[model samples]
Target chain A: MKMLGQKNNRDNREGLKGWLNPLRYGWERVSYWLQRLTGIFLLVYFVGHVFETSSLVGGRNAWDTMLEMTQTTWGHTFLIMVIGASTFHSANGIRLIFTHVGIGLGKPGRPDYPYYPSSLNTRQRSGIWIALILTAVAMLYGANVLLGGD
Target chain B: MRELDNMTVKSDKKAGCDPRDDSFDLKKTTLRVFRTNTAQGKDSHFDSLVVPVQRWTTVLDSLLYAKSYLDSSIGIRYSCRMASCGSCGMKINGIPRLACYTKISELEDPVVVCEPLPNFPVIRDLVTDFTQFFNHHKSINPYIQNLNYDKTEKIDEVSSSHSHRQSREEVDKYLQFSYCIKCGLCYSACPTVATDTKFPGPQALAQLYRYYADSRDAGKNRLNIVDDRHGLWRCHFAGSCSKVCPKGVDPALGIQLLRSYMLGISKDKRNV
Candidate 1:
């Protein structure tokens, strides 16, 4: 029994358009891309955060200067992006957890032509919507605080 | 009958006109078909042809029309001309779909971009080699295995007695999974399969869980087959497989159910 050796000849390459076009495949694919994108963003931000805080090793003056720069509009905007990414990542992560644990899915059903979405599909879609809504709410709150709106 | 008579009258008006005349007023849509000759190692190219778009015209119908009238050499594989046989799975426009099931008019775009299903070796224009797919499917031992039941007994004796039975609830557990037609669409739509060919795709893994969930099946140890590096752990739950499935067999959900089962959570308890 050859476990795994075959190589597909045709280029299955999903070009730039394939990655960019979220509406082509529907919400589930969009959610997958968004989850990956948010994960990368979070990872990069985490590394930057560690480095920024590590300025304490540069002594009191450097730490004070670094802290001062964070009070500016640019810093606030960057922080807002971080908050947005965090909100999306956290909410989507919960959705992923539920999916992996088989929470929303019911038993499989016969596929009708033209393809109707199952109850599980609908629930998972709603989960993406809920995550988007949470991200929006977080961005709004973050903006308000950072921009001195209230 | 009235609509048919009206259509006849409309065609009768253009009886003397050239068959290929654009003045016939037939609704036309462009079919952008992917063409290739792998035997000659010719570079793949898109051959776009304008096909008559009737109300009931499917993607398969358009391809067939193009093949018969426009280009005889264009290659495509189809049988049953319906969704049941699972022969005409392809990427229509961009999403994986059954060519026979997708109506040309239903597409949002006027130009229908037809390509062979991704994540498989293309033999020609629209025909893909399903050898790898079958190999992966066979690896999981898709058939039911009752280890406790002895098969060496006389067939007549087994027939005389009532065989092992299952309750309605027990049957329901694996019934949904039994609907798989092995179209390879779910595997084609999978991102994991595209990136990692070694991963036993959504189609096979779903079948694995299907048999495993059956009350009559004695293959409790079958979970070990999928628990390894290239098996169940590789699926990141992209959900593309489930999304593009023409049949409503949710392979992604099945894999998740299998995951929960492996984690020592009972199937009934995992749903909550």
Candidate 2:
């Protein structure tokens, strides 16, 4: 396939060589990788977090010990990563859902036909925004709980 | 037309007879019936028709018997009475099955429920407007895309691979999908088609893959058609279409193959 492309004359554009067109193909490639990586990472973390939470069934001390671990730097970092991944993943999912459902991108401030507030693309952007805001709040709350700042 | 008139007359005469007569042995049984006319709202209901069970009776027979005898307005659809012509597909007792193919004796009832095939706009009772279903089939350009070719040389002489003819597995894969009578049983059962009308239904997609996989179609131009948004990518591998196909055509599998083909994983033989 590479050989065929090289043999073909279509590959030889003189001017636009280095710069990538992010709109058409770049975002697609980035989103594809991000969605896959985030899904795998979040799935692993979800299982581990669920198992750690299950330790509370033993006693209050076990629960407190679990909480203490979450207060540490690694735990905090993991949570942040999870929030970022979840946001990206869910936003992309919303985008896909919209596209599949036949609700194309709609005008700004104009409600979608049959009264959906936003189009699929807009809904995806909103999902990402919501995830980011919630993540920021959660991080702040976690910090307050850990450092006794609140 | 003459055969149809004869059938109607025979059915009418039979319906006029009393099954409760001393000459006829009757056993009380339940018939779970779906109640929704096409013009009505989606708030459909089911009614059980308890009647005498008989051997060699089909689900459609039970329905016609009930409608002809017990009630006149019990809406349903049927034509030819045989499984051919692709009419009379509905959910018989939770599975998408042809009413003609189902036997009452095999059912676990006294109670049998019937509903219109899912995922298409219901026309009336058991009848659905198959216009959309067929329109999508046509949209895929189901015929082999023809282009400038040797008119003098018959197209029948196109070189076909020995593997294409000799391999039973390859033949069988296409054959499974071939059994679809276009009854819309799989269409009704498919969640993707139900949720998104634009996504070409499973049967069409399966057939699309069929032509693509054929060794005779060496031209790779067919691959360009389904690479867009509403094409192969819309399939989320729900696998419901396979589950509900009365013909056992695994359309989900075909769509997956299509996805692989679009991604260039499945080698373009012309490139070789």
Candidate 3:
């Protein structure tokens, strides 16, 4: 709280810049950062898609022009990114649901010296890898669809 | 490598079974310590001091050495050359860690960067204000109380009788979390605390679980304390709290487990 500190006290809160730096936080934070990023990107794409589809109100002429715009090389690449983001977001979301409910992390016990937290264990970290691999596979499939349909 | 022999004797490898920096080779290393004075309206700056180090010379040792010889104005907080006191927490090489616990040789870097712990207002130099951090811990009612007792009631008596005896399983539930020395390293390492000021950091949230899981603390009515938008719900299980914990107290595990109880998905509801 602002009242907690003296007026001269410097607000050293890491803020947005700290949130962007995921390298030191380990894989879970990286996944955390990526999930939020992809979610926002997808939301923007969703809004854009609504406007793109709404062009149909102008009839067949406007619809065909919209289709042509989306068929460009840059459009195809953007579509592939969308597929990748969605796949990663969904897969990681499922993993997070399980972990958030304490499903995958083993039971807490006595902490030995040189403690390694079980929540960040190999099993949980592997979930991130699985989501990434799934994202890659979906992106490749999307690339194939865009190329083949052309 | 300068005046001492820095050679590695190779042996059969299980995991890099070799002796590198095995001897306590005397070397001079620089510690780029963060310096600032909010009182005088000074901005954050680095004061790099070259200190003589051996294989086992800790960052704290180098810091104190620098303080005594290089710059008496350098502000540092330390107690117990060992890590038990939790007084010397700072960002060492971009990670919030206990300077006393971090050895120069183990870091394998000649220049050690020491800065104030992130997400906390730096009081002077590497020293940070822990008033809010401690307040967050206190907000969770970090002690056992009767189920009938409410927050308004005075919990002055910190009692532990045979009636409060816990089973082995009950002890195991929160024993690991009990190892927390309140170093504030985990709080500094938390990503949620970086931006969300109202959200109780991993340290406080972990203590919430520690008390909740304990069979003795039946203050289950207090569970909703962190149910707000800026509460435990804000924690997306970043797990940085566990990774940078100097004492191995897994705040992240406590958080997720607490979430299970809050979500009504945990196998046993008695932990409340």
Tell me the tens digit of each residue's lDDT in model 2 across A1-150: 001111212111111221122122223323444555678899999999899989989899999998898877778777767766776677667755543333343321312223232222344445445554655666566555544444
| lDDT at residue A120 of model 3 (Cα atoms) | 94
- Please give the lDDT score for candidate 3: 0.85
Write model 3 residue lDDT over B50-100, tens digit each, in one string: 999876789999999999999999998999978898999999999999999
Look at candidate 1 and give me any clashing residue pairs: A111-B248
Q: Please, what are the lDDT tens digits per residue for candidate 2 over residues B1-272?
A: 99997787677557643444344555567777767764555566777777666655788888888888886677777886777756888877765678887788787566777877656566666666666677667656666444434456654554431223435544543444455578877666554564555666678887777666554455456655666677677675444555555554556556666665566554652221
Q: Which residue pairs in model 3 clash with each other?
A: none
* TM-score for each of the candidates: 0.88, 0.55, 0.88
Model 2, TM vs. native: 0.55
| DockQ-based ranking | 3, 1, 2
DockQ per candidate, 2 decimals: 0.45, 0.02, 0.54
Off by over 4 Å in 3: A1-10, A148-150, B1-24, B147-162
Ranking by lDDT: 3, 1, 2
lDDT leader:
3
- Each model's backbone clash number: 1, 6, 0
Docking class of 2: incorrect
Query: Model 3, A1-150: lDDT tens per residue?
Result: 212232322278887888778888788989999998999999999999999999999999999999999989999999999999999999999999899888899889888887888899998999999999999999999899897776
Residue range B116-229, candidate 1, lDDT tens digits = 988878889999888889888988888889766668878887766637677666776777678888889888877777777677889999999898887777776688888887
